[model samples]
Target chain A: MQITSSLDEIRSIVKAAKKNNLLIGFVPTMGALHEGHLSLIRQARTENDTVVVSIFINPIQFGKNEDFAQYPRMFDTDCELLSKEGVNVVFNPKASEMYPDGFCTTVVPEHLEDKLCGKSRPGHFRGVATVVLKLFNLIQPDSAYFGQKDFQQTVVISRMAADLNLDVNIKVLPTVRDKEELALSSRNAYLSETEKKDARCLYQALIKAKDMVNAGENNAGEIKLEMEKVINNCKSARIDYLSIVNPETLEAVTEVRNGNVVALAVMIGKTRLIDNIILMVLIVCLITLA
Target chain B: MQITSSLDEIRSIVKAAKKNNLLIGFVPTMGALHEGHLSLIRQARTENDTVVVSIFINPIQFGKNEDFAQYPRMFDTDCELLSKEGVNVVFNPKASEMYPDGFCTTVVPEHLEDKLCGKSRPGHFRGVATVVLKLFNLIQPDSAYFGQKDFQQTVVISRMAADLNLDVNIKVLPTVRDKEELALSSRNAYLSETEKKDARCLYQALIKAKDMVNAGENNAGEIKLEMEKVINNCKSARIDYLSIVNPETLEAVTEVRNGNVVALAVMIGKTRLIDNIILMVLIVCLITLA
Candidate 1:
């Protein structure tokens, strides 16, 4: 695997590969390669002639009070893992290189940015959309892989690409989780052992919401209440937001239905962890149709 | 010249051309196709193997009260002109195709969009930036051309391409003018012959500013006053905005200096026309440095 930190070099490499009609897949990540990121890389590897992974923890996406300084930077390990996963190129751009002087343009998705994770972290999705779009412009990948762990992020990026008529396909894979069902996150590194155990409540809460929907409880409020109860039981857990929303629109739904997602964010001590589960109603409908 | 209205077909054509190592140049226009647009097309033809022009009068760029509905679109005449100019492809997409339902993303250059023409037309630069970026993504041109008649627009777009790390090079050609020195514009169609004659005030005002600057009057206010006087002399003309500014930033400058721009917009019988001239100090500096 080739590791590059220059934007020009990576672009030339990708352009040359593209000239030869090779399919390119990109996986953009903030470099503390966990199981979630590895899953995305693995998927990209299986599908394309070239798989490029970018590991820049975009500073613009973090709020002023967020854990940007403390965000993990295990580059050596990250590169080794990516190499093992058969990622053809690893793009590790410095912040200065990514956001050069006089960088003033931003991509803003008007509607989808005000709900779910966007509520607590203002300017977060704008930053995400801008950086992701920049990466897409640089790489010009045939397809980009994203994990469903950051559900709202996936939705925002997909919407931006479609609305802007970007000529790249956005493919989202299912969220990867630990045996305990805690959705893997780079922020998971911040958790103490006890806090890590408590973090499991997020996944449990999502499962609780899913089970309620499976049992024919269509009321969004009741499902949220039961899920909140599960999360509130963890001593170290503090609920930030527990929403049952239309997955695509990110709008709060009054009643749960097929294709809705029960997404949550919680603070396990100082660490904020997010996880979600798509409702089973869609799967049930598919089975019935089959 | 081949005319295409489908995004997918254009992408395939561009991709095939790119594979053959052809340098592509793009000129995006709202298609009344005057000499101003022809100048850009001519420059593109000289510098690239393939020149693609897109005629899209973007609705999002026009304010509700503005002349979006009345925007001149002469497709057959435009095509004839492009063919004569040796344009390889003409992309004339419908508004619905370019911005289908659920088109919600916008590219905004926050600082540059609120000055000069932006003051009179809110969200104008935002729409221009978004559509131009979309076209860049679709075409992936090696170089994109713009006319300097819309000086602030050129500044905004150049800033956006740089900030977003877009791969295409942005090239600004000089504004094309008629024998009367009136800058060619699609909106010139809205004017009656008498109004058209009155519209010469825009170019005349710019010339007045240039004469003042050449006479060593450094005060921006003084230069603007003289320019406005020339424009206000026309009985049918109404001053929209008349100011001298730093060309790159589009910020109002108290005093004219090297690289300052004199930009103005005037309304003649409900038709708005804009014109600008870069200061001679920069030209002198260039000659001295050379």
Candidate 2:
């Protein structure tokens, strides 16, 4: 695998691939790759003639008190895993290279960014959309892979891509989970052994919500209360939000229905982990012949 | 030449051209074509294998009181002009088609969109950037052409394209003017014949500013005073903003120098018009071998 830090080099390489009629697939990551990121890379490799991976921890996405300074950066190990997955080019640009001194353009999604995580973390999706667009322009990918672990992120990106009429297809894969059913995240590195175990409460709460919906309990408020209780069982866990929302719009649904998503964010010790499960109910309707 | 209003048709046409290794050049306009728009199309035709011209009178770029409804849209005549210029295609998507039901994305430039035309027309550049980006994605042009008549627009778009790392080259051609030196604009149709005669004050004021700068008058305030006097010569012209600024940053320059732009927006009766002229001073540096 070729590793490049220069934007010019990567542009030339991607252009050359395009000139040869190569179907380019891209996976954008923030380094410190885990199984979730690796799964995305593996899927990208399967789909395209050339798979390019970008590893830039975009600084604009973090808030004032966010753990941006302490976020994991295991570049060597990440490259090893990516090389194993047969990634064609690894774009590892420095922060300055990605966002030069006078960079000030932003891609903002209206309505979609006013709920859920957007309420707590203002301008987060703005940063994601901006960086994603920059990477999309550089790679000009036929398809881009994203993980469902960051559910809202995938939705935001999808909406932005569609609204902007971007040519690339956005492919979202299922979230990769650990043995404890906790969503694999790079931030999980901040968790201690006990906190790591407690982090599973997020997934457990989502499962509880899903079961309630599956059992025909439609009240969204009731489902959230039960989810909160499941999360409260863990001493280190703090419930940030437990929402049952429309999977596409991210709008709160008072009455849970099929295809509703039950997502949660909880702080387990110093690490804030998030996980979600899509509530699916198979409907059977009896047809009466007139 | 074929004219398409369907986005899907345009995308397929552009894609087929791309597959055949044709270099695409794009010219985005708001129809009502005149010499200014034709110049941009002529440049696009000269440079690329295929030239795609988009004539969309974007509604979002107009404010509540602005003349979006009354904006002249001469599609048949505009297509004739483009066809004569050897244009490969003309994309004229409807407002609903471009901004579908749930379309809610905007591209915003920070410092760049705060002055000049942006001050008078809030959210104008945001709309321009968003629509331009959408068109850029659809056309996938190797280079895009813009007339320098909309000086702030060119700066805002150039900043947005650079910040987002869009692959297309942004080529700015000189502002095409009429016999009376009035900058060509679609809004010119809104003016009465007498008001059209008075509109020459915009270019007259710009020339006055340039003359003042060339005459070793460095003070921006002094230059503006002279420009105001020149523009006031017209009975119908009302000065909106007369600014001497750095061409790239669009920031007001305290003292006039080489590569500075004197841009203005004026209200002639009910119609608004904008014009600018870049000041250039040749500098000679003496080099001696030691």
Candidate 3:
């Protein structure tokens, strides 16, 4: 395994892999590396001969008052985890390395950027889209693995990749969670003992909506009201947005279809955590480049 | 030489070329090939073992009322010219082939998109940046060629390519011109015979500014004011912008320096044309990326 901070050196590794007829897989993260991240790494390792993981806490993706400054960094621990997981290469670049001075380019996914997480955290998806694009170009991976926990992010990235005609496949893995029903996240570290328990209520709210959706209670407005009730019942929970939206479009829909995810963001104390439950099983299809 | 319209076919060509360690050069154009475009292709052929020219008249780069529909497309003539120029492959995919249904993503160069031609033609640079990015990914060239007649565009694209970490080298060929000093462009065809003669004024105005800066002139504002006078003399010509901008910053400079280009855009009759002349030879040395 190779550890490179330089973009040129990393490109050489990925380029050499392709020249030797090896398929490449990429896992891009901000590098606090929980079990959830490891899950993505394992999938990428299984799919390709060479796997590259990038840890860039992109400042562009964070809002002015957001946790960008206080964001977690466990580079040595993160490297140990990736090394143990058999990652072929790890790209841990400073903000200066990834974004030089006077960098003014950005990738935006139009209307999709105006809803869900994008509405509250403006320019969040733009940051994600831009960084993901930069990583895709830098790594030139044959395929990329993204966790479904960040549902809208996966959709936005997939659309950007396809729209830009990037010659790579995007493989979306299922959402991973903790035993307490809390969605595993790097921000989960910010939770106090009590706040951590209250965090599970977010997952509980999503589950309540999922049950209603599965039991033929399809009025989206009615279901959202009930989900909000579940989250509001908790003492420490503050609802950011408890709306049931179309899984793919990320638009709020009145009627629940067979393929919508119960998505929402709730602020438990100061830390914001998000989780979603898949309503249906999707047939996994392989996309041949041809 | 391979002529491929399908993504898979082009990917295969790139894959095979990579295996053989052949350097690939890309020339992305908007179809209607002219002398200006040929100069780029010739440079690409000289620089790399394999050359791919993508002739796509990207619709996104055109304003709502612009001539996207009436854009001259001499496909057969372009193919013959490219072949004669020794272009190894021409990837001339139809718009439908390039942009299938559900294409929703766009790439934007933030600060630069709102200036010069970007002001006159809204969403123009967005379309150009997006399609050029797509071509950059698909062709995966060792180097790409562009014309410097489109100065702001070349600057914005160079920033985008570097910021995105796309491995392809970008080379800007010096602008090719006709005997009358009109910058060579396919759109020059739209001008009437008399309008063609009037177009020479566009370049003439740039030369007047170049002369002022050459003769120990320091104030950019004064240079711009005098140049606009020359442009106003032509009754048929409408001055869009006469800017003495720092080539790197793309900002108005009150004092001219050793590194600046006096760029201008004008509308003669119904035809819009643009031209620029770098005052100091040292500006070429200051440019970090070409």
TM-score of chain B of 1: 0.95
Evaluate candidate 1 and give its CAPRI docking class based on DockQ.
medium
List of clashing residue pairs for candidate 1? none
Q: Please give each candidate's TM-score.
A: 0.95, 0.97, 0.94
- The local distance difference test score of model 1 is 0.90
True contacts kept of each: 0.86, 0.80, 0.92
DockQ of each: 0.80, 0.80, 0.76
Native-to-model Cα distance after best TM-score fit, residue A63 in candidate 3, in Å: 0.7
Of models 1 and 2, which has the larger TM-score? 2
TM-score of 2: 0.97
Give one digit per residue, the lDDT tens place, for model 1 in B143-189: 99999998999999999988888888999989888888888888888
Cα lDDT tens digits, model 2, B1-290, are 98999989999999899889899999999989999988998888989999999989999999999888898868888888888899989999999988988788889998888799999899999999999999999889999999899989899889888999998899999999888999998889998999999999998888887777777788999989988998888899999999999987888999888989999999999889999989875465899989
Model 1 ranges off by over 4 Å:
A282-290, B282-290
Give the lowest summed-lDDT range of ten residues in model 3 chain B.
B281-290
lDDT of 2 by residue, A174-229 (tens): 99998889889999889999898888888888888878877888899998999899
Q: Model 2 in CAPRI terms: which quality?
A: medium
Backbone N/Cα/C clashes per model: 0, 0, 0
Residue-level lDDT for B223 in candidate 1: 80
